[model samples]
Target: WLRGTRKDPPTLDETIAHENKRQQLEKKPINMLPTSYGRDAAQGGTGKCSA
Candidate 1:
């Protein structure tokens, strides 16, 4: 089923799971970048790599 088409609020577990999944997906690209920018600000340089 489509997530947005649901009528009822998600359960606590479902909500948390969805949040975790979203966070993971959001972080994956940064973590996958060929740099330590995800862990260190200094190493990230100008931080315009992704821009």
Candidate 2:
């Protein structure tokens, strides 16, 4: 098996900071709106037609 180049492991402080950031992101509310696709003029998307 071919092994890729490995990087140094994160320090204690770095690991703690990463975990804290992950937790903060996990608690954040995901506010996303549905989008429209295709050439349908009625549906909202790129208003103008493509060449």
Candidate 3:
């Protein structure tokens, strides 16, 4: 019969699981860089600093 031959699509739970797995695999780490001014404020081996 048509009904028996047709396959059902993924359910809500299956969809959520697939999405979660995809997100986990596509995750990336953040890269940070300090500004030049920030580096200057650190002082060049002066050992004196102010916040």
Per-model TM-score versus the true fold: 0.43, 0.44, 0.41
Ranking by lDDT: 1, 3, 2
lDDT of 2: 0.41
Query: Which predicted model would earn the best lDDT?
Result: 1
Candidate 2 error regions (>4 Å): 1-6, 32-51
Mark the regions of model 1 whose C-alpha exceeds 4 Å error after superposition.
Answer: 1-5, 30-51
Give candidate 3 regions above 4 Å deviation.
Answer: 1-6, 28-51
Rank all candidate structures by their TM-score, best first, as comma-separated numbers. Answer: 2, 1, 3
lDDT (Cα, 0-100) at 2 in candidate 1: 20
Q: Write the per-residue lDDT of candidate 1 for residues 1-51, one digit (tens) a residue.
A: 124456787688776765675466457654466445444345432233222
lDDT of 3: 0.42
Which candidate, 1 or 2, would have the higher TM-score against the true structure? 2
lDDT of 1: 0.49
* Local distance difference test, each candidate: 0.49, 0.41, 0.42
Candidate 1's error at 4, in angstroms?
Answer: 4.8
The digit string of per-residue lDDT tens for model 2 on 1-51 reads 011253656668766765675456446565522232223334322232211
lDDT of 1 at 7: 77
For TM-score, the strongest prediction is: 2
Cα displacement (angstroms), candidate 1, residue 22, comes to 0.6
